[model samples]
Target: MKMDYEQNAKIFKALSDSSRLKIIDILSCGEKCACDILEYFDFTQPTLSHHMKVLSDCGLVEVRKEGLWNYYSLDINNCNKLTLFMMNLVTETKDCICKNKSNCTCK
Candidate 1:
C-alpha cells in the first residue's frame, strides 16, 4: 500500500508528546472511559480532551459516546498500517548509490 506522508506525519506528530503516548498505552489494554483515562494523569479535563482530539484527528484512536460519557480506544487497523509502513521504510530499499561520481566504487 502507498504511504500517505501527510497522514503519517500527523500520526507521528500526535504521538510526539509524552502525555499522548501514555494515553495510547492506556487504551492498548481496552476501551476506556474518559474518566478512567484521566485517573492516570495529573492534567485537567480540558487538557485530556485536547490530547484525545489530537489522537482522534490522527486516526490513531477512536471515540464513542454512551450517555454523558466518552470512551476511547486505539484504532488497531491504522496502528497496524503505521507499523507496516515504518517496517517497510527501514527494511525496503532499491540500492545504495555513492554521491561522489569521481570515486563511485560502491556495489
Candidate 2:
C-alpha cells in the first residue's frame, strides 16, 4: 500500500511536542475524561484543550462528549497504521522508497 506522506508527516509533527507525547501515553491505557487527564499535568485547562485539539486534528486521538464532559482515547487504527508505516520506512522492505531508485547503491 502507498503511504500518505503528507498525512504521515502531519501526524509526526503532532507527536513532536513532549506534552502531546505524554498525553498520548496517558490515553494508551484506556479512554479518560478530560478532568482525569488534567490531574496528571500542571498546565491550564485551555492549554490541555489546545493539545487535545492538535492530537484530534492529526487523527491520533478520539474524543466524545457526554453531558458537559469530554473523554479522549487513542484512535487505535490510525496508531497502528503509523507503526506499520514506520516499520516499512526503517526496514529494507519491499516497499522501501529506495527500491524504486535505479541508481541506489545499497542493493
Candidate 3:
C-alpha cells in the first residue's frame, strides 16, 4: 500500500520529542491512565496532556475517557504501518549511481 507522506510526517514529528517518545515507551507495555502516565515524568499535567494530544492526533496513540481520567494505548495498527513504511523506504529497489561510484550494492 502507498503511504501518505503528509500523515506519516505528522507521526514522525510527534515522535521527535523525547518526552513523547518516553510516553510511547510507557504505553508499549499496555494501556495506561493519564495519571499513571504522568507519574513517569516531572512535567505538569497540562504539558503531558499536550503531548498526548499530539500523539493521538498523529494516530500513534488512542485515548479513552472514563469519568475524570483518560486512558491511553499505542495504536498498534498505525505503528505497524509506520514500521512498514520505514522498512519499505530502505528495502525498496532503486537504481543509484553510487553503486558504481563507491562500490555500493544499492543498484
Candidate 4:
C-alpha cells in the first residue's frame, strides 16, 4: 500500500505528547477502563478524554463504551504497521523516497 504521509504525520504528532505515549504504554498491557488509566496520572477526566480522542483519531488506539465509561486498547495492526513504516523509513528499500536521487548516500 502506498503510504499516506499526512496520516502518518498525524499519528506521529499524536504520539509526540508524553502523556499520550504513557497512555499507549498503559494500554499495551490490556484494555482498561478510563478510570483505571487515570489512576496512573494526576489529570482530570476531560483531559484524559482529550488525550484519548487524539490517540483514537490517529488510529493508534481503539475505544469501546460501556455505559458511561470508555475502555481503551492499542490497535495492534496499526501499531505494527507504524513499526514497519519506521523500519522501512530508515532502511534503503527499493521504494525508498531517495531511490531516484543521485545524492542519496545510503549504502
Candidate 5:
C-alpha cells in the first residue's frame, strides 16, 4: 500500500489544534451547522470558519449546504480508513514473528 504522506500530514496538522479536535468530536455526534458549532465557543465566526476550513481541507470533515446554512459532519469513511491503517501498522505479523508465537514458520 502506498502511504499518502500528504493526506496523513494534513490530518495530523488539522488535529494538532484542540479546537479542531473538539469540533470533530462534536460533529461525530451528528451533523451540525456552522452556527451551532460557534455556540460552543466565544470565537467570532471567521475564526471558526478557519478551523472548519482546515478540517475540510484535511478530509476529516465534510460540509453540505442546505439553503443558506452550511452543515458539517465527520467523514466516517476517511476515519475508518485511518483507523484501519493504524491498526495494520501496529498489528502486522512480520514484527511479532517468534517473539511470542507458539509456532514459528518464518525462515
Candidate 6:
C-alpha cells in the first residue's frame, strides 16, 4: 500500500508529547479504560482526555466506549505502517553482501 506521509506525520506529531507517548506505551499492552490510564499519571481527567483526543485524532489510537468507560487500543495497521517506515529508513543499503565480495559494508 502507498504510504500517507501526512497521516504518518500526524501520528508522529501526536507522539511528540511525552504524555501522549506515555499513553501510547500504556495502551500497547492491551485495550485500557480511560480511568486505568489516568492512574499511571498525575494529570487531571480532562487533561488525560485531551491527550487521548489528540491520539485518536491522529489515527494512531482507537477509542471505544464500553458503557460508562472509554477504552483505547493502538491502531495496529497504522502502527505497522509506522514501524515499516522506520525499518525502511534503517535498511537503506539495497544490495546484499552475497552480491558483492569486497565492497559489502553491511554488517
Q: Point out the worst 10-residue segment of candidate 6 by lDDT.
A: 90-99
Greater lDDT among 1 and 2 belongs to: 2
Compose the digit string of candidate 4's lDDT tens values, residues 1-107. Answer: 45678889999999999999999999999999999999999989999999999999999999999999899999999999898888877777888787568998655
Q: In candidate 2, residue 30 scores what lDDT?
A: 99
Counted clashes in each candidate structure = 0, 0, 0, 0, 0, 0
Give the TM-score of each candidate. 0.85, 0.94, 0.85, 0.91, 0.79, 0.79
Residues 1-107 of candidate 2: C-alpha lDDT, one tens digit per residue: 67789999999999999999999999999999999999999999999999999999999999999999999999999999999888877777776777789987655
What's the true lDDT of residue 76 in model 3? 99
Cα lDDT of all candidates, in order? 0.88, 0.93, 0.89, 0.92, 0.84, 0.84
In model 2, which regions exceed 4 Å deviation? none
Best by lDDT: 2
| Residue 95 alpha-carbon offset, candidate 5, angstroms | 9.7
Give the per-residue lDDT digits (tens) of candidate 1, residues 1-107.
56577889889999999999999999999999999999999989999999999999999999999999999999999999999878766653333234236586654
Q: Name the lDDT value of residue 19 in candidate 3.
A: 96
Instruction: List clashing residue pairs in candidate 4.
Output: none
lDDT of 6 by residue, 1-107 (tens): 34466877788888889999888899889999999999999989999989999989988889999899999999998788899866665464454333367765566
Best by TM-score: 2
Error of 1 at 18 (Å): 0.3
Give the runs in model 3 whose Cα sits over 4 Å from its true position.
Answer: 94-107
Stretches off by above 4 angstroms in model 1 are 93-107
**Which is better, 1 or 5, measured by TM-score?**
1
lDDT by residue (tens digit), candidate 5, 52-95? 99999888899999998999999999988777656655675555
Residue lDDT tens for model 3, 7-57: 988899999999999999999999999999999999999999999999999
| Model 3 superposed RMSD (Cα) | 4.4
